[model samples]
Target: MAFLEIDSLHKTFGANTALHHFDMKIERGEFITFLGPSGCGKTTVLRMIAGFEAPTRGTIRLDGRDVTHLRTRQRKVGMVFQAYALFPNMTVAENIGFGLKVAHRPQSEIKQRVDEMLQLIKLPHLGERYPWQLSGGQQQRVALARALAGKPQVLLLDEPLSALDAKIRISLRQDIRALQRELGITSIFVTHDQEEALSISDRIVVMNEGRVEQIGTPLEIYNYPRTRFVASFVGTLNILSGHVIDPSTGRMAVDGQELRTAQTLPVGDAGKKRMLALRPEAIVLEAPAAGRNTLTATVEEVSFLGAIVRIRTRVKDEVISLDIFNDPNRRLPERGQPVALGFSHENLLVLEEGVQG
Candidate 1:
């Protein structure tokens, strides 16, 4: 049985539909992230799960029990929002203990749990400090602690790390993931940041315009994107358009060149259109190697990005991008130089012809 399930959950505000039959199943103690761009209804879905918003249609089941109509305070779900939402007038200890106190827990028990929560966030020493006294990252950690103090069944984090600096965001994400693992709590994280979702989530739900585009492990979403939107939204990819030359064999012709693919062309519209999705890391700039997809491309741009060198090449009318490890001894290729690019059949994904967004 699923720990939490959202079945055909529909939400509408006036004439605008926020979620269109959105659905997902979350396992017990699993970390699933709702990933999408702004105004894509990811946060709206999180709010529904947390009981802050009611769905227009469909049922929300928690551990086989329906909780669709439960109030926010009665759903037993903890939430940490983007702004930290810490009360500037309250100290960290008071904030963390607020939930327990509101529930009328004994003073000694609240004190003990607050102390443990502080220690869990690695800031036991900052309990007496106000929100203003703490750094942005530290303040967010306190917010997390306050949320966890309630010991809810599910933890919903809505872009909690987006407000922090890059360095602090990186560090706190790892810390949050570690704390979740230690506690074995089911978590639903919502974010638009691709890197953040890829690094932290066990599974990612790529949302677009109130619909679920794809849901899978990070590797599956990145390497074998089911649709054009998933391929472009989840990571950097080179989309090449073509037509299926052999409808029976799933061979596609790209810019007059044939490329082998793993996906069979869908029936009835076989020769109409086709496309291939290839990742930047999958394509390599090297001499013609045996038994690999080789394309002779003219180098157009070379960018140095610290650890790896990004090279843009022109193959016919389309510009293909590939990344190579930075080698100090190797001479950087000049612009307009002709280079052979190679990729394996496994790396080149044949997909339906569609514009990546």
Candidate 2:
């Protein structure tokens, strides 16, 4: 059996359904991330696992034991919140040892465990300081340490780094991933940030309107999104309306321009209008090599985003965004100039037209 399993999970508040028929199984010691926009039910799933909210209908199993009805404290799950829920009056050591104290562990054991956690978080000398004396990043580290001190079966991080600055958030996320791996603890992280999820998770569960849209590794999720929402939400994609011309040959027409794709149309989807998804980074400014798809477009806008150059071009009436790595030798085309945009057929994905949720 999987270490963590959620089966047919459903949550409803009166007439509104927050989650529907959600199912997932996680391996032991794996880092999984629930990623989605606000009100998408990502946090609800985390809360259900942590026993903070009832599932309405579903079962949560941890290590073959049913934990759906267990109390939060009895579930032996550690949770770190975005707000850094540390006690202001308690010193770092006190906060880290709070769970052990509640469980009535021996005082000497608690001290040793706290010291080990402090060293693990790289703040061994800060034990004497209170929460107020620490920076945002430091407080978050303490919160993480406190969560892990109990050695819970699973660690839940609910946007824990959302309150920190960008640089600090980046730094702390790396630290958290390293520590989680070293401890070999099963962890679930909830975040709306795409890059964070892509960077750290062993697998990503993309959620929408309380439904699991797609669950896969970062590369699979980014390169071959199964749903239109996943393609649009996970990264910068050019979703263009097109019609399937020949399903057998993967032929399609985009804005009246015929092109061949690497994906076949779904059964009964031929002759119907569909949406094609392509990553901005997949587009090339120069003419493609032989056997590649090429389109002529007029450059509408150019934006330099540090290490990347974003070019907005108009093909027929649709605007397509293309991202190219910034190179010192490459010259950017001016607005209103015509340029050839080239991409391989394999880079294009034929996505479902309508929203899933």
Candidate 3:
């Protein structure tokens, strides 16, 4: 059996539904991420799992025991928020040992555990300082140490690094992942940032408008999105509208140009208009090769993003973006220059016609 399971979970506030039949199973020591934009129910799922919010309908099972209606204290789950919720009146050591103290652990044991936590977080010398004396990043580390000090069964982080600067956020996320792996704790992270989710998660659950769009590994979610929303939301995708000419051969027409795809169209989807998703890096600006789809386009704009060059080209009425590695020795095409774009059939994805916001 899975270590943790959320079955048929549903949450509603008044007339507004926050989550709709959300279900998931997490293995012991697995790292799962709930990735989505604001108001997409990702945070709602996290809160429900933490026992902070009661589900209108469902069951939460941990180690084969039902905990759906359990109180927050009974769940033994540790949570770290976006803002470091450190007690202003306490020292770092005191904050880390607060949970142990509340449970009436011996003073010597609490002191030993607090010192261990400070060493684990690499802030042993700062334990004597107060929260107000530390930087934002240091305060967040203290908060994380506090959450893990109790040795809870599960750890939940809700945008914990979103408040830190870019460099610190990157560094702290690496530390958090390493610590999670070392402790072998079942963890769930909630974040709207795609880069962070892709970098840290063992599996990603993409949610949209209170529903799950897709659930898979980072590579599967990025390279083989199952829905239009998943294609557009997970990464940078160029969606082109077209119609399938032959479902048996996977042929389609886009912007007055013919193209082949590796995907077999649905039985009744032939002759129907559909959307094709292609990544910016998939399009190549080079001479057309055999068995490749090629189109003539005019360069509309060029942007140099360190290590990569982004070129926006106008093909008929549609604009397609292409990314090429930056070569200091080679010259790039100027604006208004005509160029030929080529891409393989395998990179072209036939996605669902309707995309949810």
Question: How high is each candidate's TM-score?
Answer: 0.96, 0.97, 0.97
lDDT preference between candidates 1 and 2, better one:
2
Candidate 3 lDDT over residue span 288-312, tens digit each: 7899988789999999999999999
Model 1 local distance difference test score: 0.89
After superposition, candidate 1 runs with Cα above 4 Å error: 287-290, 352-357
Best-to-worst order by lDDT is 2, 3, 1
**Candidate that scores best on lDDT:** 2
Q: How close is candidate 1 to the true structure, as a TM-score?
A: 0.96
- Model 1 C-alpha lDDT per residue in residues 1-357, reported as the tens digit of each score: 799999999999999998899878899999999999999999999999999899999899998889999988888899999999998898999999998998999999999999999999999898999999999999999999999998999999999999899999999999999999999999999999999999999999998888888889999999998778888888889988877777666677777776777666667647767557899999877797776778888999999999999999988977899998999998988999999889887888876443223
lDDT winner between 2 and 3, please give it: 2
lDDT winner, 1 or 3: 3
Residue 10, candidate 2: alpha-carbon lDDT: 93
